[model samples]
Target: MEQIALKAEKRDISKKGTINELRRKGKLPGVLYGKNIESSPVAVDAKELLKVLKTHGESALINLELEGEKHPVLMKEIQRDTLKDAIVHVDFYRVSMTDRIEFNLPLVLKGDAEGVRMGGILQHQKRELSVKALPADMPEHLEVDISGLKIGDTLTVGDLKMDEKITVLDDPEEVVISILAPKLAEDTEVPTGEQAAEPEVVAKGKEKQEEE
Candidate 1:
């Protein structure tokens, strides 16, 4: 539901050379399309988009301003360079405020549980969830409090709260987060025979030195 303004410009020429040149100038090549809108190659400030991704973590909605028109969009796919790991291209879906849309919202745990404090390992199996809801009703994050969690306690999709307009795509009883038993270290160290004998020789050398 949080919105950030991004400035974009329509592209007349779409080619690999042009895109690479744009990247050299720190611009990101992207396409925006949805519903009845025509897909157009557009360019936006790369640094600004990176800042938004950092602040919103892919879950935050974007308000893209192309020329003077504002479009509410969701980041559909981001393509990064394999060697450089830099964002090369991005795909955005223009969304309507009134229509219901599905998104994979991230799950965040709040509070340190007693079980985790008691030598239990906290395991998060799933990071995001699929939910259908209106764009205005979409939550930035799905918070699940682990304060009451025990060693074997688990939180499932059904345990989470959703808006009346939201529908969850995952199984109701699917375990999302759980605490497991902490791994214990082995009791004894098993030394190799040759390495163990080398220690005795060093001890003998020390004994001989002491005798001198």
Candidate 2:
């Protein structure tokens, strides 16, 4: 729950051309807003923001230093350039340390599934779980061990162990992971329409012979 330090400058221009100009100068445009707080347009060094994202990820608390005033915030949304794979814009949500906030935590699978060794497929239905916790009590990730899993066994959200301070927001009955039975040859080798019709054609020919 350590907060990462970042600095941002207030932005006056919001036009598309101006935003592109800022990006060419290695700046990223963003906005900061929260309960009881007025929204403010801001910009920060793109390289610095990338470094913070790489180190702290999106769920961690950020100490956003804006014009000498420090705001504890969380990254709410990030828009990326799909082709260039660069951050285009971001949204920050200010938060109080003691307030409960909801966020998604990654699910980590530990240990190999016993069913996998038996030719079964290991499937993960939920890769992350939504949780509510205080800023200081948030966990980086949740883990589930699958070493004891057998074919047809399913692990649900209710099966996970969590910290007392953290409340899982996901449905308790929702599946998180499971070991599925191995696929049979027939299951994988479905016959084409023509191939399937051949058997029906042969059956009809036998009926015609009996009639004759």
RMSD of each: 5.5, 4.7
Clashes of 2: 0
Q: Best-fitting candidate, measured by lDDT?
A: 2
Task: Look at candidate 2 and tell me the lDDT of residue 102.
Answer: 95
Model 1 is weakest, by summed lDDT over 10 consecutive residues, at 182-191
Clashes of 1: 0
lDDT of 1 by residue, 1-212 (tens): 77878989987573558877888889998999998789988999999999999888786788999879999999899998899978888898899998989899898889998899988988899888999988877788888889888887888888888777789999999989898876655436666789779989999999999999
- The candidate that wins on TM-score is 1
Deviating ranges (above 4 Å) for candidate 1 = 14-16, 183-212
Q: Going through the candidates in order, what is the number of backbone clashes in each?
A: 0, 0
User: lDDT of each prediction vs. the true structure?
Assistant: 0.87, 0.90
Model 1, position 130: C-alpha lDDT score: 92
